[model samples]
Target: MLQGKNIHFCISERPIIGEVNIMVAPGELTAIIGPNGAGKSTLFKLLSGDLTCNRGEVSYNGKPLAGFKSNQLAKVRAVMPQHSEVSFPFSSWEIVALGMINDPAAISDRDIQAVMEKLQVWHLRAQAYNMLSGGEKQRVQLARVLVQVWKKQAFPRFILLDEPVSSMDVALQHLVLDFMNELKQRNIGILMVLHDLSLVANYADQVIMMKHGEVMANGHVSEVFTNQNLESLYGYPIHVEKHHEGLGLLVHSLPIHHINQRINKAL
Candidate 1:
């Protein structure tokens, strides 16, 4: 499991994340949702070891994150940031291969090919990553991250993604999430920052709601995704309805009149 205990971060003496606690266990899909500047990305950075926390501890598999060397940590965790840039005109295949550079295992071409196919980007393997469309590039980058953690190890591993599907179409969004589900089934923990509440309602095993750098709520989706909780989190009236198929929750904004009424009452 990946664990953050009493985590706090600050920028120039201004707090960004305060006393946040989170855990991502193997085979679980944990989604972090919040408004803009709500510290979702900052939390991700702390967990991924991209930024050191000002206080508290981040651990993976019972060991402190500070103890692991960069390459050692890469073997157990993969991170896909909100924005990725490829300066050179590297082919998609080459970009994916970069994931294995620090890996000591003798990763084969077949392994790389499988990950690309899983991401639905195998056809673009020969294309230049710099030349692909935004969605295509995102998929390729996802493929790269997947390759990093594709092989299972004796201990648990994790993937941290930040708004990975922001550029994907609806169809591709489902496809990418389906791939993530498959990874979870393989006992790979996933922690993602997403703005899509419906997706959170449908796909996440656990949800963490944040506002102003503090954790407002965290638990199973059914427990924390109540209409009242969401309304308070987003500071707007939101309705939670059952899906017709009865498999997932559907969330929608309240009517404008209802929203205005709620605001007036609050004021």
Candidate 2:
């Protein structure tokens, strides 16, 4: 489990990530949702140990994150960030293999192969990673993270994905989230930053909504995703509707009351 106690971040003089206590356990898919500037990405970075919080303790399974070496932390929580490449001519297979290069544990080529196969990127193994489309590249990256945390069934695992589905098309979004849920079934905890409320409604077991560096709501999917929550978070009157797959959100545009307030204030 990854947890933060009074976690906070600062950029120059501004507090970009407000302090909060969060506990993420294993075997559940957690979604971090909010509008722009809500500190979702910043919080993800802090939890991934990419950035140090000014005042807080980020512990994993009762051990201080600071106590773990870079490789040790990498082994426990595999993080997939948003950016694509510094330079990329590496084959899809090679890119994933790189994930195992600096590992503290001994992982054979067979392990890397298995991760790619699990992600269904094995056929593209020989293809140059850059040659693939945006979504394909994203999947390859995801496969890389899978390899990073890819341990035999005995050990625990956690996967952190930041906007992984943004590059994917609609159908593929479902595919990716479905795979994420399957990972949870495999006892892999997933902490993902998702922008789509509908996906959060349908797929996530829990939701953590943030705004302007503060957490607005955090609870189970059914409890956290509500019409009132959406309106408060995004300043719009959004509603969730049921679909065959699960829940779907139909945002009927911004509220007339909000528009009226803006008009009256402008007057």
Best by TM-score: 1
Q: What is the TM-score of each candidate against the true structure?
A: 0.94, 0.88
Model 1, total clashes:
0
lDDT of 2 at 179: 76
Cα lDDT of all candidates, in order? 0.90, 0.82
- Residues 1-267 of candidate 1 have per-residue lDDT tens digits of 999999999999999998999999999999999888999999999999989999999999989999999988998899999988888889998998888888737477898998888878999989999889889888888888888887867788899999999999999998898888889876799999999899888889999999999999999998999989998998887889998998778899968888789789999
Write model 2 residue lDDT over 175-258, tens digit each, in one string: 778777667766688999988877788788889989999988999988878888988999876877666565455434556888
RMSD of each: 2.4, 3.8
Model 2's alpha-carbon lDDT is 0.82
Query: Model 1, residue 10: displacement in angstroms?
Result: 1.0
